[model samples]
Target: MEFNITESIQILTKTPSVISNLLKDLPETWIKTNEGVDTWSPYDVVGHLIHGEKTDWIPRALIILGENEDKAFVPFDRFAQLKNSSSRTLKQLLAEFEELRTENIQKLQALSIDEQTLERKGIHPEFGEVTLKQLLATWVVHDLGHINQITRVMAKNYKIEVGPWTKYLAILRDKK
Candidate 1:
């Protein structure tokens, strides 16, 4: 299907609530457990999403709409959540994420993005020039991917316990 700003907005707005419903008030073991080394827990995923809200999406959208065609986006810090959110409780992170997402969604709507605007270009640090559509689409997919990551990480907690069913659960299947 074609990239529709209205359709994208639908998923974008729901991400916070979807995450909150799946994660809030869970035990620390469920919140903090990772799939393996270097993987993110549900808590860490929320922080990473928060970091994106502050620095990635709208910031890059502005760059795309800005007059400076040469202005490349700042590279995102993929692991900033480890230290940035370590001291905060999962509850705090969840609440903050909700607020940030709501604000960003409002900002996105305020842009009044049209087909012409979606075609606007911005420089990406690694990928060179990219369109607003690609960025917005990525924003939607990024949320979905992370949500999948959160679920997979949660599912991995039961990998061994699932026993016979593990063979049918792709998320828990050994990738190696």
Candidate 2:
């Protein structure tokens, strides 16, 4: 489907509530399990999302919109949440994510970005040049990818219990 800013915002706005509903008040077994080493649990993913809210999305958007001649964005630390989130509860991270997402959506609306603005370019450290539209789309997809990751981690919690039925469940069978 084509990228619609309004449509994108719909998914973006719903992510916090979706995550909260899925994991809130659940037992530690569900909230804290990971696929394996180097994989993030639901709580960890929430912290990562919070980190992105604070440092990635809006900051990069502003760099794209700034008056500076050089449009290069600062490199993003993909794992900053590992350290930062160690001290915070999942509830705190969820609340902060919701607040930041709401504020950001409002700010995006206030910017009054149009077709021309979406086409504006910025420099990515690894990807070279990219457009505002691509960046915004990435923000939406990034949230979704983490959500999927969280669910996959949770499903794997039942990997052994499911036994033969695991063959029917792609989420459990797909070891990646």
The TM-score of candidate 2 is 0.97
| True-structure RMSD, every candidate | 1.2, 0.9
User: Which digits, one per residue and each the tens of the lDDT, describe model 1 over residues 82-167?
Assistant: 99999999899999999999999999999999999999888888898899999999999999998998898888888889899987
lDDT of 2 by residue, 38-113 (tens): 8789988898888888888889999999999899998988888899988877788888989999998888878888
Assess the local accuracy of residue 65 in candidate 1 as a C-alpha lDDT between 0 and 100: 92
**Residue 126 lDDT in model 1?**
89
Model 1 Cα shift for residue 83 (angstroms): 1.2
The top-ranked prediction according to TM-score is: 2
